[model samples]
Target: MMTRYIAFLRAVNVGGRQVKMELLRALFEQAGFKQVKTYIQSGNVIFDAKGQEAALEAKIEQLLQQNLGFAVPVCIRSIAAVQAVLDNNPFPGVIPDKDFQIYIAFLQTLPGKEATAIIATLQSDIETYHLNGKEVYVLMKKNTGAPPFSNTYLEKKLKLVATTRNLATVQKVLSF
Candidate 1:
C-alpha cells in the first residue's frame, strides 16, 4: 500500500527566490505522486507514494532539480511519524503571540550531543533549544529578524545538514 509522506524542501520560496506552489504541486504530480498538496511557500508537500524513505527522497530531489534548475534539500517522513513529532513537542504552552517560535529541524541522521555541543554553547538570551530524537524544538523570543536565534546558529554550529519549519507550518502539514 502507498503511504503518506511529508517532504520539507529547503530554499524554495524564500530569500528572493520564488517558486509558485502550483508549480511545486505539478512537479510532484509529474513525478507520479497522488494527493499532492503543499502547506506553505516554504516547500512543505504531502503526497502518497509507494517506496521507502531513502529511495523516495532521491526521486523527489532529482525531479525538483531537473524542473527548477538547482539543488534543494528534501526531508521525508511518514504521516504517523510526523504526527508523533508534533505530539511529542515538549515545549508547548509557551507564549503564543510573542516573538516565540518552535521549529522542527530534520536531520539526515540523529547526531550525538558531542557533535551538537558547539551549537549548544553559542546560544544566548534569544534562544532556548530542546532535542527530541531527530527533531530539535527551539523557542526564540527576540525580534523577528534578529538572526533567527535557533536555525542559522544550529546549522553553523553542528556542521551537519539540517532543515527547519515553523510550528504553524508543521501543523498545517499534519492536517493534510
Candidate 2:
C-alpha cells in the first residue's frame, strides 16, 4: 500500500550546491516514488511511497548523492505530521501577524534527553523556540533582524540532522 509523504532535504541549493526542480522530480521518479512533486527550491518534496519511512529517507538520500554528486540529509514526514506541528503551536499566545513567521525544523529523529537539554540552552535575543519530539517551532520577531535560528545550529547543539521550512511553504506543500 502506498502512503503520502513530505520529504525535507538538507544542504540543497546552498553552500554552492544547486539542484534544479525538474531534475529533482525526475530523480525521485527514477527512485520509484510516485506522484513526485517538488515545492520551493529549498528542497521540499511531497510524494507517494510504498516503503517504510526510514527506507524511503535512506533511498532518497542515496539517490540525491548519486544524482547530485553530494550527500544531502533527508527527513521524511507523514502528511499528518505537518498538520500536527501546526496545531501544536508552542506559542499559542503569539499573534499571527505578517511580521512574524513560523519556521519548523524537522529533526532526523527524536532527540535524546541529553540532546534536548543541550538545545534548551540555546539563547536567542530575537526569537523564541520550542523543542518537541522531532519538530522545533521557531517564532521569529521580525524587525529585530533576520531570524537567528538555523538548521546547522540545531543539529550542532542537539546532535541531529534537520531541515527547516517556513509555515507558508509548508502549507503549500500539502496542496501539491
Off by over 4 Å in 1: 144-146
In candidate 1, what are the lDDT values of residues 72-92, reduced to their tens digit?
778788999899998888776
Query: How accurate locally, in lDDT, is each candidate?
Result: 0.80, 0.83
Writing each residue's lDDT as its tens digit, candidate 2 over 1-176 gives 88899999988899999999999999999888899889989898889889877888899988989888999899998888887877887876776476776778899888887865675677476677788889888888777766456778878888788898877777788777
Whole-model alpha-carbon lDDT for candidate 1 = 0.80
The global Cα lDDT (0 to 1) of model 2 is 0.83
**Top-scoring candidate (TM-score):** 2
Count of clashes in candidate 1: 0
Candidate RMSDs in Å, in order, are 2.1, 1.8
